[model samples]
Target chain A: MTKLIVEVQDLWKSFYIRHNRNDSLKERFISLFDGRRRERREVFWALKGVNLEVAQGEMVGIIGPNGSGKSTLLRVIAGILRPTKGSVTVRGSVAPLIEIGVGFHPELTGQENIYLNASLYGLTRKEIDRIYDEVVEFSGLEDFIDVPVKNYSTGMYMRLGFAIAIQLDMDILLVDEVLAVGDEAFQRKCLAKMQEFKERGKTILFVSHALELVSELCDRAYLLVNGQVILEGVAREVVACYHRGQIPIRHE
Target chain B: MGSWMRGLTRIIRYRELVRNLVAKDLKVKYRGSVLGLLWSLLNPLAMIVVYSLAFQYILRIPLENYPLFLITGIIPWNFFSGAVIASSEAIIGNANLLKKVKFPLEILPFATILFNFVQLLFALLVFFPAVFWFKTGVTPLILLYLPVLALQFLFTLGVAFFLSSITPRYRDVRHLTEVALMVLFWLTPIIYSISMVPGKLQPLIKANPLTAFITVYQDIIYWGRLPSTEMLISMVLWTGLSLGVGYSLFRRRQRVFVEEL
Candidate 1:
C-alpha cells in the first residue's frame, strides 16, 4: 500500500467567544470588584471528533457549508491550530496556502514580499533566490516587481500569493479557498499547477465550496457538517449528495 | 530536554526569518526619512546635551567627563527600554501572520530585540569617537565589550519574549511597559553615578538588574578598569534568570496565541 502522508484521528478543537472582552488589565481588575462587570464567554467547538487519513499522491477534497469547520480542519493540519483532543500525524512537510499573502508587508515591494512571504513558509535565502525569477515570471508581475505590494490590486496580490506558494517544493499542499479571488486565466493556471503536483505524486488536501470543481478534481471527498463527516466516498457521489441538500443544518 | 533541543534547531533553521524581519523593520523605519540612519544617533545626542546641562552644570554631578558616562549608560539603556517597549507589539501586531502561518512565533520578539540592537550598534558607532575626544582613553579591558554586550542582548531578548507573550492576552502591557521603563530609567544610574546615590540605597541600586550592566560599561569605557566580580556575577545571573523565566513562559503561553489573537 502507498504510505499515508496525512493522518488526523479523533480531532477536536474549541474556541471561546468572549462577551464584554476584558482584554485590558483595567477591565479585568474592575470586573473583580463589580459582579455585573464580569466578562462572559461561551465555548465554540469548531471541530468535533474529526478523523481523516490521506495517502501520498491522493487528491482529497473537503466540502462543507459555511461554518462547518472546513477551514479549521485545514488550519489544524497545517499545524497553525492545536487540537483540543486527538492527534494529527503528517510524515512530510506541508505548504499551507490557507489565506495566502499571509506575511506580505504592505510597505514592501513585490520583490521584497516574495522573499518575506517565502521565508515565512520556511524557505531559506538560497532557496528563495533560486525561485525568485520563476515566482515573478509566473505571477506575470515583472514590470511592477519593484513597486510596493500595497499598490497592487486584489487580483495582483492573490496572484503573487499563489505564485509564491506554488513555487515552494513540499510533500503536501493544503489549499483552502485560495482561488476564490483570482480571474479565470489565473484560476486555470492554479488548477494546472495543482494537477501537475498530483502527477508528481504530491498529496493534496483541498477545501472549497465549488462543488463541480471538487467532483471533477478530487479522487475522493468528505462532506463535513456540524463538525463531523456526514458522508465520505467517491467525489461525484458526495457532490451529488450535497447537491440534493440531504444533510441537516444544525442550529445553535 | 528534547523539546528544548527541537526549539533550538527550529530557531537555527529560521535564522533567516529573524534577519528578514529585522531588515524589514529597518527599511520601514527609515524609508521615508531624509536623514535615515542618522536619526537614531540624534536621540542620544540630544539627550546628552540636555543631561549635561541639567546634571553636570546645574546639579553638578561630581563625575569627570559626564557626557561620556551618560553616553555609555544612556545608549545601552535606550536599547533595553526600546526593545522591551517594542516587544509588547511584536506578537499582537503580527496577528495575521500568527493566525495563518506555522513558523516559529518566538522570532517575532527576537526580531524586535534585534532591530533595536541594530540601532544600538549604530548609536555606539557614532558615539565611540566622543569617548576618545573626552580623553577617557580606551584600555585593553574594553575588549570585554562584545562579551558583555552579548549578555545584555540575551537579557533583553528574554524580557522581550516575556513581554511579547503576555501582551497578546493583556492589552495594557504596552502601557505598563512604557511606565515601568520610565521608572526604571531613573532607578538605573544612566545620568548619575552610583556613588552619588544615598549610602542606605546603595544595595537597592546595586540590586537593580540594569545597574550591573550599565556599571560594567562605565568600568570598561569610562574608568578603563576591570569590572568587579559582583558586577560580573550579577550580569550572568540576571541574563540566566530572564531567559529561564521568559522563554519558559513564552513556550507555555504560545500554544494559545492564535486563539488569543
Candidate 2:
C-alpha cells in the first residue's frame, strides 16, 4: 500500500468581523471611557471540521461552488493559512501553484523574474541556476527573456508563470484553478505535466471548477460545500453526483 | 527557545531570498528616475544644503562645521525613518502575495529595511569624505561603527516586524507612523547638539532609544571619540528589548495576518 503523504484531521478556521462605526482617536477615546459603548465583533467560520487524506503518488481533486471553501482547503493544506483547530501533516516539500506569478515584479525582466518567482517557491539560487536553461526553454520565450515582463503579452506571461512552477520537482503539488487562465495548448501542456507527475509517483491535490478536468485527471475526488466535505469517492462518480445537483445551495 | 532557533534557521536558509528581495527593491526604486542610483547621493546633499541654510544662517547657530554634524545624524536617522515608514505597509501592500504564498511574513519588513540600509551605506560613503574635509579626522574608535550599526539594524528589524504585523489591523497605523517619525526626528538630537539643550533636559532627551545611536554616530563620525559606556549599554538594551518585543508580537500576529488582510 502507498504511504499517506498528506493527512488533515478535524481542520477548522474562523475569522472575526469587527463592527465599529468610528476608528478615529477621539471616538475611540470616548468609547474607552464609556464602557457601555464598546466595539462589537462577530465570528465567522470559513471551514469546519474538515478531514482529508491523500496517499503518496495519488492524484486527488477538490470541487465546489463559490464560497464552498475549495480554495480555503487548498490554502490550509499548502500551509498558507493556519487551521484554527485540528492538524495537517505532510511528509515532504510542497510546491503550491495556487496563484502563478504571486511574487513576480513587473519592472524586472523575464530572466530576473524567473529567479525571483522560483526563489519564492523555496528554490535555492543554486537550484534555480541548475534548471535555468530548462525553464527558459520550456517557456518558449527565449527571445523575450531579457525584456521586462511588464511588456510581455498576456499569453507569454502565463506561459512563463506555468513553466517556472512545473519545472520544480517537489513531492506534493497543490494547484488551484490556475490552468483555467491559460490557452488551450497551455492547458493541454499542464494536463500532460500532471500525468507525468502521477507516473513519477508524486502526490497532487488540485482544486478546480472544471468537472471534466477533475473527472479526467483525479483518481479520487472530494466535493465540498459550506466548508464541509459533502461527498468523496471515485472521481467519475463524484463528478456525476455534482452534475446531478445533489448538493443544494447553502444559506449563510 | 527551540521555536526561536527554528525561526532563525528558517531565515538563514532563506538568506538568498532576502538578498534578491533587497536587490529588487533597490532596482525598482530607481528604475524610472532620470538620476537613477545617483539620487541616493544627491538626496543627502540636498538636505545638507537646505538644513544648513535654515539652521546656521537663518537661526544663527554657533556650532562650527554644522553640515558635518547634521550629516552624521541625518544619514542614520534617514535609515530608521525610511525603514519604519515602509514597515507600515509592508504586509498590507503584499496582500496578494501573502494570500497565495507561504514564506515568512517577516521577510517583507526585512527586505524593506535592508533596502533602506543599502541606501544608508551609500549615503555614508558620501559622508565619510565630508568628515575629512571638516577636519574631524578618522580615529581607531571608528572600527566600532560596524558593531553599533549591526545593533541598530536588529532594533530596526524588530520594530519593522512589529509595525508591519499590526498595520493590517489598524489602518491608521500608516498615518500614525508618519507623524510618530516626524516627532521622533526632532525628539532625538539630530538637528542640535545634546549639550545645546539644557543640562536638566539632557536625560529626558537621552531617554529616546535613538539618542544613544545618534550620539554614537556623532562620536565616531564627527568627534573622533569612542561612544560612552552608558551610550553603548543603552544601545544594546534597546536593541535587545526591541527584538524580544518585536519578534514575539510578530510571531503572535503572523498566523492571523492572512485573515485580517
**Model 1 per-residue lDDT tens digits across residues A1-252:** 999999999999999999888998999999999979899999998898889999999999999999999999999999999999999999998899899898899999999999998888778899999999999998999999999998999999999999988888789999998898999999999999999999999999999999999999999999999898888889999999899988755565
Q: How well is candidate 2 docked (DockQ)?
A: 0.56
Top TM-score: which candidate number? 1
lDDT of 1 by residue, B101-199 (tens): 899988899889999999999988889899889986888998999999999999999998899999989999899888988888888888888768999
TM-scores, in order shown? 0.98, 0.95
lDDT to native, each model = 0.92, 0.86
Q: What is the lDDT of candidate 2?
A: 0.86
TM-scores of the candidates, chain A only: 0.97, 0.91
Q: Candidate 2 residues B1-261, lDDT tens each?
A: 886787887777777788888888888889889988778887678888999999999998888899999998988888999899988788998898889878877778888888889998888886778877977578888898888899999999989988988887777878888988888888899889877989898888899999999999888877877779999899999998998898899899998889878
TM-score of 1: 0.98
The CAPRI category of model 2 is medium
Per-model i-RMS: 0.8, 2.2
- Compared with the true structure, what per-residue lDDT tens digits does model 2 show for residues A1-252? 889999999999877777774344555678888866667779888888889999999999999889989888889888998889999998998888887877788899998888888877767899999989988987889999989889988778888887888788889989988887778987898789889988999999999899999998899999998888888899999999999998754465
Candidate 2, which segments miss by more than 4 Å at Cα? A19-39, A248-252
